[model samples]
Target: PAASKNTIRVNSPRVRCDSASAEKKKIMCTEAEIEQKRLAALAKRRQREQEQQQQQKKR
Candidate 1:
């Protein structure tokens, strides 16, 4: 599956991880969790860009 540029995949929810950590693993996630992470990342990126623009305006 091809995710968009800003999407993050840390052990895809579709795949199972059966390493020594399987006991500590949860393969499936709620839609809310996925969307929350994506939104947080996007907000962080936007903030960084805004800060960069402000710095450029100062210079």
Candidate 2:
């Protein structure tokens, strides 16, 4: 029975490893979200610049 308890103790680190991987996935998801938002904002700014240039040319 003591050997079984030792085996359980040895397996504890695997649980920690699983949680660490979960944390990494969460961080990667947030980073991807941030990148998507940045790209959208950049596209919006470029569109506005193009509209302004077109208006200036019309005048």
Candidate 3:
């Protein structure tokens, strides 16, 4: 099935690669794994915020 702009098509190469690397039919992360993931995600969000702030400053 094809996806709209907001969705990732499951069979797309990039999406398939990303999903395959990320999860192997698992739902629940272990507590440690969850915390690690949470921290990594928070770091990524902060990086994005910093980048956006820099962009806004430039504009």
Decoy 3 TM-score against native? 0.50
**lDDT tens readout by residue for model 1, 1-59:** 46653244645542445453454543334556888899999999999999999999999
Model 3 stretches astray by more than 4 angstroms: 1-29
C-alpha TM-scores of all predictions: 0.50, 0.79, 0.50
Which parts of model 1 are misplaced by more than 4 Å? 1-29
Q: lDDT: which is higher, 1 or 2? A: 2
Model 1 scores a C-alpha lDDT of: 0.70
* Tens-digit per-residue lDDT, 1-59, candidate 2: 99999999889988999999999999999999999999999999999999999999999
* Worst-scoring 10-residue span by lDDT in model 1: 5-14
Candidate 3 on 21-54: residue-level lDDT in tens?
A: 6675354456668989999999999999999999
RMSD of 1: 18.0
- Please tell me which predicted candidate would have the highest lDDT against the true structure: 2
How far residue 8's Cα lies from its native spot in candidate 3, in Å, is 58
lDDT score of residue 50 within candidate 3: 100
| Consecutive 10-residue window with the lowest summed lDDT within model 2 | 9-18
Among all windows of 10 consecutive residues in model 3, the one with the lowest summed lDDT is 1-10
- The candidate maximizing TM-score is 2
Given candidate 2, what's the lDDT at residue 41? 100
